[model samples]
Structures are given as structure tokens and as C-alpha cells.
Target: MPKPVLIVGAGLSGAVIGRELAEAGHVVHIIDRRSHIAGNCHTARDEASGVMVHVYGPHIFHTNDDEVWRYVNRHMTFMPYVNRVKTTSAGQVYSLPVNLHTINQFFDRTFRPDEARDFIQSQSDPSIGEPVTFEDQALKFVGRELYEAFFEGYTRKQWGCSPADLPASILKRLPVRFSYDDNYFSHLYQGMPEHGYTEMVARILSHDNISIELERNFVRSDAGDFSHVFYSGPLDGYFDYELGRLGYRTLDFEEFQYDGDYQGCAVMNYADADVRYTRVTEHKHFSPWESHERSVCYREYSRACGPDDEPYYPIRLSGEQALLAQYVARARFEQGVTFVGRLGTYRYLDMDVTIREALDTARSCIRAFADGLPLPAFNIEP
Candidate 1:
């Protein structure tokens, strides 16, 4: 009999890969350090309010990939959700992404979309030829006033660094709209799972060939027991951080229950640096499909990740990238193991992209296994 494949971490990456491999006739064993599944996207019902709360943080699944969208829908019902974020800045409320409504409200003008665009163009600094830093990109695109109000304070609080120090790529992800389109994500399919992410993951791992164990940690020695190992833990931790610790920013959530509505929206950005926490998320707003008298909210604080903290976002600055390169080199030389997922690859990934990569990775692995070839250390570069 062939040995069962070992999958470390019962998150989306492991679950998707395991499901695909199981369907391909491979027995799979998946484990996670946490008591629950879905990793950071874990959601559970608030016992008192019966509101399905995002335990770690809010995760609204949005994707452009039809295959990925269809795959998730096969497991759980997803209700249509549009994330319209709001921001509190300079003692006034504003729509996020600096849309036409936000610009008009901020400047107290009734300019049309075209006039607004031309006005913004005049506000933008033309001196910046090729933007390098995040500050430069913001100023070149949206001008100082909008940058200061929207990106500056919020970015500093979220990353624990000035926008001037961050790369331009960071600010490029956010889009500035001339119209009143306040939807945070521009993806074609945007929704929340009906039951919750945990339930969806549970359904994905329900096949007879896949067995799961929670609250079980994966160490280096466990690799020998399986035919091949799909490791979704931190790449540095695989070697026990022998080289050095990579930099990461971890989140501290101040969870509180409210008798009624806390915030009108799912997410509210506190753009002022003095505000301390980056944003306050009202979990009830995340699932509009359900009704609840009480609400669950989290005041999210971002800080430098310590050894004991759960790493949220990887700080891929030059210094961290140097250390990551060392870890990547070591990972490449390691045998019989493949590193995958956010922590495994040291990259922040949206749920849709994670699932897409998992599906592709599984197909690649199945093909290699059939051809009696060695598996690559990573499906992507770290």
C-alpha cells in the first residue's frame, strides 16, 4: 500500500490541495496548530447574538477567476456582498478610495466626474517623473490633500512606517475612481459564504480519503512518515529559524460585543495617525444575509510581529527580503517537501488567489507523482 500524503495546516491552501489530490486517489492527512480550521479566515457564530463572526478578521471572497468562483460555490452558498468602506478623517466621514463623492465632500464642491478628474489632475504634482516610493505615487496620482487624508496616516498606522519608506507597489493596489463607485473591490464575483468559512472548509475536507486533525503542530521530523509532504507553515520555521527571524506585522484585535449596530459598514478606516488602531470592523455587517440584534466588532491594531505572535503580513522590505532569500535558497535544497500558502511563501494573498494557486499546485503535484519525478520546493517564488 502507498503511504498517505501529509498536509500541514488545515487552511484553504491545504484543504484545497488535499481535496484535489484525494479526488486523484491519494489518501491525505491534514493538520493545523489551531483548534479550529480556516486559519485566519475562521468564523464562528456569536452564541448570544447568533451572528456569524469573523474570529480573526473579516474575509470577503472576491474573485475574477470563474473556475475559482465555481469551485467555492460548489461547497457553500455565497450571498452577494459589496464592500463599501468608509473613513473617518479630519473629524469628518468620507467614502474610501477617494471617489467623486469623497472629493466633493472633502473640498465642499459639486463638480461633475470630468471636472473632478481635471481638478484632481491640477492638484497632482507633475514634478514626480517616475514614482519610486509610496508617498511619491500617492502625490503623483491624487495630490497632497487626498494623500494626507486618505493614505498617509492610515498607511503609517497599518504598516508602522511612513509612506515615504514603503514601495510604490503598495499604493498601486488601491484604485482612485472619478465616479461615485465606492465598492472597495473591483472583482466580478464578490460575496460571503452563507454558513461561514469554517463550514465551507469542513465541506471541502469531507471526502473519505481526507482525514483531519486540529491542534496538532508540524515539526521537521514528521516528513518521514508520509510519501510526500505539503508544508503550509512558515518557511523560516521549517528549519526552526536557524538563520534568523524574518520581519512580519501581526494584528492585535480588541474584540467587543455591542447590543446594537456598532459601525454602519463592515470596515471603517481610522485614517488619522493619532487614532492608534488602523480600523474598526463590525462583524455583523460582513454577513448582511443574517439578522442580529447584537453586533461583534474588532478594533484592529497592527504592530511588529514578535516570536510568539501569529504573523499576519510579511514585511518584505529590503532587509527582510535579504533574509527571505536565504530561507528560499535553503527551501530549494530541502528534499521530499513542498512549501505553500501565505506564511509558507511569505506573501499576502487574497482568498481567491490562494485557492487558484492551490488548484494549480495540486495538478502539478499529481502529474509529477505519476511521472515518478521529484517535487519542487515551492509552487511560486518566496
Candidate 2:
């Protein structure tokens, strides 16, 4: 019998890689420090409300990659879901993405798409030739009024930093539309797994040749037992933070249950500086197809990640990036192991990106094995 390939962290990265390798006739052992199969995307039923709650937070799978979309559908049924985000700012509710509807609603005027576009252009700061910071990007794109009402306070609260401190790339993810399309993402496919993320991940790891061990804290010593190690855990954690811990923002969710609908939406952003929490997400609205009498909601608070806290978002500022480069250099020299996934790469990755990269990494590993070459430290560079 061949030595089993060891995959640390049973999240999408490890699970997908393990499934691919196992299908190709390699025995794979996948493990997670957490007892659950799915990582942050873990979803389960709330006994009190009988609603499927996103235990960590809401994860709506949206992607433009047809192959990746098909890959997930093969594992489980995906129910149609479009994230129509709503925001409350200064005692007024508005459609998110700063759409034409939002503009007209905010100004209390009816304007056509072209008229709205012209009006926003007038509002935009012509002085900003090129946006370098998040603040600059917002001011150049949507101008002061819209930026202050929609992005400024929300961003400050979410990242726990001034908008000027963040890169322009952060604001680029959001689009200011001239149309009434309130859909949060412009992806080709958008949905949630019908049975829940946990079930979907479980099915992904259900191959006979793939064995999963939960609550197992994988260490460097365990690498000798396997042919190769695929680590999806935090890159810094893998090295015991020898180069110092990478900065990250962890979320504090205050969960509460309410009768019937709480906010009448899946997500509601509190776009006000006075608002302590960034957003409130109602779990039942995540699966609108399902009927529930009660709803479960979470008021999300963001803060600097501590040692024991579960890191949510990587704060890849200049300092953190410099530290990450050092870790990446160290990882390149490490033998018999390959770092994979969001934490491994120390980047914010969506579910689709994670799956796509995992698939690519698995293929590379298989090719490297066939060619009698050592597996690369990272398939996708951080």
C-alpha cells in the first residue's frame, strides 16, 4: 500500500484537493482542528427557530467560472439566491451598491439612468486623477455625499480603520450602478447549497480513498507519516509564528432570535459612525425558499484578531504584506509540504476561488508526482 497524502484542514481547499487526489487513486487523509467539516461556511439548523443559520456568517456562493460552478453542483443541489443588500444610513433605508434607485431615493428625485450617471459625474471629484486609497476611490467614483452615507462609516466600522488607510482595491469590489440592479454580485451563477454548506463539504469528502479526521491538530511532526503534506491552515501558525503573527480582523457575532422577520432582508448594513456593529444578518432570509416562523440574526462587530480568536479577514497592510513575503520565502524552502487556501496564502478568497485553486493545486501535485518532482510550496502565490 502507498503512503497516504496528508491534507491538513478539512475546509473546501483540503476537501476538494483530497477528493481529486482520491479519485486519481491516491489515498488521502484530511483533518481539521475544528470538529466541524466546513470551516467558516459551516451551516446548520437552529433548533429554536428551525431555520438554517450560517454559524459563522452568511456565505452565498457566486462565481463566473462555469467549471467551478458545475463542480459544486455535482456534490449537492444549489438553490437560487441573489444577495440584495440593504443599508440604513441617517434614519433612511436605501438599496446597496449605490444604484440609480439609491441615488434617486436619497436625493428624492426621479432621474433616468443617463441623467443619474451625468449627475454622479458632476458630484465626483475631478481633482482625483487616479485613486490610491479607499477614500480617494470612493470620492472619485461616487463623490463625498454618497461615500459618506454609504461607504465611509461602514468601512471604518468593518475594517476598524479609516477608509484612507485601506487600498483602492478594497472599494473596487463594489460597483456603483446606474441601473436598479440591487444584486450584490455580478457573477454568472449565484446560490446557496440547498442542504447547507456542511452537507456539501461532507459529500465532497465522501470518497472511499479519502479519510477525514476532525478535532485533529496537525503538526509538522505528522508530515513524516505521509507522502506529502497539503496544509490549508494559517501559514504563520504552521511555522509557529516564528516571523511574528500576521495581522487579521476577527468578527464578534452577537446572535439573537426574533419572531417572524427581523429586518425583512438577508443583510442590513448600518452605515453610520454611531452604529457600533457593521451589519446585521438575518439567517432565515438567506434561504428564502424555506418557510420559518422565527428568524435568527447576528449583529457583526469587527476588531483586531487576538491569538485565540478565529481570524476572519487578513489585514494585508504594508507591514503585514512585508511579513507575509518573509513567510512565503520560508515556505518556498520547506520540503514535503504545500500551503493552500485563504489562511495558507494569507489572502481573502471567496468559495469559488478556493475550489478553483484547490482543483489547480491538486492537478499540479498529480503532475509533479508523475514527473518525479517535489511538490511546489504554493500553486498560487500569495
Candidate 3:
């Protein structure tokens, strides 16, 4: 008889992997430190407002992968959603991602697309060849005026660092559209789960062969009870931070209640250093399908992650990468355990990518089990 598999953390990674393995005839036991499922993407309805509030923050589902899109749809219904981000800079609202409309509004000019492109090109620093930092990238891409107006202060507040200190790749994530299209994401599919992420995750983990235990932490001794373990907890945490802690930025949300609409949008970025909070998220706006007289909003602030704080974004600066390399080397040697998910891999991952990796990992593990071989430490490199 095959021994049951143990999965740490009942988040997307663990749930998806457990479901896949259960269907393959393996008994799966999943556990999470938190009382509820759906790690960071947990969504719950406000009793008073009857609004589905994004507990951690807003998680807009946008994916180019057809398989991932279909997989999510099979479990829950997704309503059409297109994120149109807005930024407040110098007491004025501007369209985000520096689109054609934004350029015209910011500069107070009605230049055509070609003219706008040429004007921006002329404004950009011609001396810079191959940008290496966030500030440099912004200047090269949109010139100093736009960079200072939109990205400079926001990046500082969100990352807890100056734009000049951050890597150029960080700025590359944001797209600068030439047209009037204000859709924040360029993905083929974009939507929000009709019932919320928690309900969707519950459906994903509804396999008969799978069992879950929440508010339970994984111990080192527990590894011996199962044939193999899929650990989706923190990578540094697994080793008890033996090589010292890795750098991460954690978010502090100052939630406020309002009788009427708050921001009038799902997310609003404060592109000024004067504003202590990076962005404000009005939860009610997230689910336009549901109406709510009262709204729940969060003024999000980012800071250095402490020992007890829930780590949000991994600070992959040079020093952190050096420390991460050591942890990765250590994780590779662990027997009968595989590190998975955002925390385990120490990288920022979108929901679709996380599910995709989990599915692939389960298939790989099944092959290993059939061949009577040891389980892999990591299906994807950290």
C-alpha cells in the first residue's frame, strides 16, 4: 500500500497539488497555519455591507495561459473584469501605465499617437544606453517628467527604497501603451471569481481522497509520517533561518469603513512621497457584480518585514540573492520533501503561474512515485 502524501500550507500550491495527486489515487493531507484556506488571496463577505472584501489585498485574475483560464472556470464562475488603474499626482488624476490619454492630459497637449511618441522620445535622456536601475529605465522609457510624476515616489513608497537603488527589471513589469487602451493587464483573459477566491479554492480541494487541517503548523518530525511532503511554507523558515533571514517587504493595511463609495475605483495609486500610503484599495469596487451601500477600503503601507510579519514581496536585492542562494543549496539536499509556492520559492508569483506550477509538480511527483524514485526537492527552480 502507498503511504499518504503530506502537503504543508493549504494555499493554492498545496490545494492544487493535493487535488491532482488525489485523483491519481494518492491520499493527500493538507495543513495550514491560518484557520482559513486561500493564503494571501482569501476573500470573505462583510457581514454588514454584504460585500466580498479582499482580506489580504486585491487579486485580479489575468492570464494569457488558456489551460489556466479553463482550469479556474471549471471550478468557479468568473465575471468579466478589466483593471483600469488611476494615479493621483500633483492634485490631478491621470490614467495609469502612461497611456496616450495620460500623456495628453499630463502635458496638456492633444498630440496624436505618433507626435506623442516623438515628443516623449525627445524628452528621454539620449545619453543612457541600456538602463540598469529603476530610475534609469523610467527616464529612458518615459523621460524625467513622467518618471517623477508617476513612478519615482510610488516605487519608493511601495518598495521602501529609492528608484535609483532598485533594479531596472522592476520598472519593466509596467507596460507603457501608445493607444488609449487603459486595461492594466495585456492578458487575453481577465476577470474576478464570482463567489470569491476562497470559494474557488474550496472547490479545488473538494476531492474525496484529500483532507485538510487548518491552524496547524508543520513540524520536522511530521515528515516521517508520509511517503513524501510538498512544503509550501517559507524557504528560510524550513531551515529555521540557519543562514540568517532573507529580506522581504511586508504590507500594513489601515482599513477604514465608509457609508458610500470611497475611491470610486478598485485601486488608486498615490504617486507622491508626501502620501504615507502607497495605494488605497476600495474592496467594494472590486466586485462590481455585487452592490454595497457601505464600502471597505485599505490604505496600504509597505515596510521591512519583521520576524512575525506576513512576508508579502521578496526583496531580491543583491544581498538577499546571495543569502537566497545559500538557502536554495540547503533546500536541494533535503530528503523526501519538495519546496513549492511563492514563499517556498522566495519569488513573487501570480495566481495562474502558481497553479500551473502546482499542476506540473503533481504530474512529476506521480511519475517519480510510479518509478519507485525519491521525490524532487523543487519542480521549478527558486
TM-score of each: 0.99, 0.99, 0.99
How well does model 2 score by local distance difference test? 0.94
- Cα lDDT of model 2 by residue, 1-382, tens digit: 8799999998999999999999999999988999899899999999998999999998999999999999999999999999999999999999888899999999898999999999999999999988999999999988999999999999999898899999999877659899999999999999999989999999999999999888999889999999999999999999999999999999999999998899999999999999999999999999989999999999999999999999999999999999999999999999999999999999999999999999999998999988899999999999
Q: After superposition, how far is residue 166 of candidate 1 from its true place, in Å?
A: 0.5
Which residue ranges in model 3 land beyond 4 Å of their true spot?
none
RMSD over all Cα atoms, model 1: 0.8
| Model 3 CA RMSD to the hidden true structure, in angstroms | 0.8
| Lowest lDDT 10-residue stretch of candidate 3 | 170-179
For model 1 the local lDDT of residue 26 reads 99
What lDDT does candidate 2 reach at residue 371? 85
* Model 2 spans with C-alpha error above 4 angstroms: none
Give the higher-lDDT candidate: 1 or 2: 2
lDDT of 3 by residue, 1-382 (tens): 7779999998899999999999999999999999999999999998888889899989999999999999999999999998989999999999887899999999999989899999999999998898999999999978999999999999989888899999999877657777899989989999999999999999999999999999999887999999999999999999999899999999999988999998799999999999999999999888998888999999999999999999999989999999999999998889999999999999999999999999999999999899998887889998
Best candidate, lDDT: 2
Query: How high is the lDDT of residue 41 in model 2?
Result: 94
User: Which regions of candidate 1 deviate over 4 angstroms?
Assistant: none
